[model samples]
Target: MFDPQTQDQPLPQRLTRTLIIGAVVILVAIGGFTLIRDQFTEEEPPPPEPSAAPSPQATAQPTAPAGGDNLAQVDDWFPHSRTEFAEAGGVAADFAADVATIDYTRDDWDSHAERLGQWATDPYAVTLTTADGVAEGIWRALANDADAWTGSADVVEVTYFDPTSVTIVVQVQAEPDTGEDPTDLGEFSVDLTTNEGPGWRVDRAELLR
Candidate 1:
């Protein structure tokens, strides 16, 4: 009688077969991931930015003269004398003189001429006309020089500036001469800005014949 016996694989052979199958599955999964990598990737670069611009700044401005400058202007008015500057206005005498006067008093003769000269010469000549008594008559004393300048003198002065305008004020001394002397000692001056800058002129003068 033949016994029924089936052939069986060895334990070592079975183990080797299972290991080979697992290695094959792992290799397939790695290859699949490599192929699909691009689909899972991020390709967008960050948005570009614009550069910033520069900012602006403020500039500086100039200033005016001092309380003494007006006196300096008056000083400029002296010396030229009525004969030399009959046309310049705002002289004190335009109101009183029958004719603009002349500075004929001996240069050594003290008082009016000396006082006025001294006062007007000071850039800081704000001592009060009653200080020299000639600030008002300076132009009148010089108007009588008929040979140098002529015509009726009008010591007219108008506001050249205003505190409302740039915080500075200017007064125009406009005296046109009358070839003769004024009857009274007519002299006057007005106080305005202390300094002389920013288009402000001193007591500029002129003579006409």
Candidate 2:
């Protein structure tokens, strides 16, 4: 509503008062509108923070077998090198196979003894030639009865090793010429020792079973 007293004022004073009142009304209306809008308006949530990426898993390294380092020291005090042990293992397996094999039609006791001696040390070789009761063993009996046999041997592993010797265990299988299935003669271990010449030779042999 317009006040009549305001019209009694001078024009400049009247104009200034009108402007001041109009400004005050405009500020009040703006403040009221802001408060009302705030009550009904929902504040938008802050933009979601980006999640961190997962870290990569570390790869596992292969662990060496136990006593692996000892292999490097194989020839330090040993009679043979690592390479020689491999050769000796093969020789031992061959000797074990020869011991298991018996062919009466092919080799006599003397010839077999000589063949065995080629791979054996003097002590072992002597036993092959003159060992009593060997002629009376099952193989000899089989040979006496006109039977022949064949055999094969596979090296299982080196059972014992040292500077002076290594013993290899083998699985021996034999089949008689009588159409029978091959017999598993059980395991045999051959001990090899460094001899006078280059490589290793069989010193002893034994049946595990």
Candidate 3:
């Protein structure tokens, strides 16, 4: 009975402990894998970006000129100039219409005003009768705005009733003030006889309004 070889071995305590520890490790691994399965299976794609739109406003353009407003303007030139005889020769008699147009700020505006004033009274009155004769001659010479100058006022026509007598056409516009529409204010026939000059200026105008 006492033979060591024949003895019932007391359960190997160390071996039993090792087997229990291995069983615990296997159970923990199984639980962790079960919990992680759902996370590994699910997938979500990212969102897309938005697009931009275009603008609205349009581009700009230039303006055009008025019709025969030019004729209306020239219609004013003849009589306006008739008031002054001194500077009324070359440029005045020629195609000098643009005074109100191209020459507005150019040329001697003072001269224009001075001559215009003289036509009414003052030192200019000395030659009143002669001036009137010249103006009348111009009035008789020119008929209407149409016969005078067109477009840019590049032309003019004058007719003499007698050697020293003439008739001219004139137009007036109440512009830069009341309205854009121009009015044919009046046409005039001036009479004058002067020893100083054949064509003096309009001493006085006979309103043919």
The most accurate candidate by TM-score is 2
* Candidate 3 per-residue C-alpha lDDT over 63-163 given as tens digits, one digit per residue, 9 for 90 to 100: 55656458656745454344333233322222112212212233243443444434333433443234343332332333232222111222123433344
Error of 3 at 106 (Å): 19
Ranking by lDDT, best first?
A: 2, 3, 1
lDDT leader: 2
* Candidate 1 residue-wise lDDT, 61-159, digit = tens: 656656666865774554433332332233323322312323434232334343433313235233313334333344445445432322133444443
| Alpha-carbon local distance difference test for all models | 0.38, 0.76, 0.39
Could you estimate the TM-score for every candidate?
0.24, 0.59, 0.26
lDDT of 2: 0.76
Candidate 3: C-alpha RMSD to true structure equals 17.8
Tens digit of lDDT per residue, candidate 2, span 85-182?
A: 78888988787667657888788788877877888888788876765422224355456433676767888898788777899988877678888787
User: Which candidate do you rate higher for lDDT, 2 or 3?
Assistant: 2
* lDDT score, candidate 3: 0.39
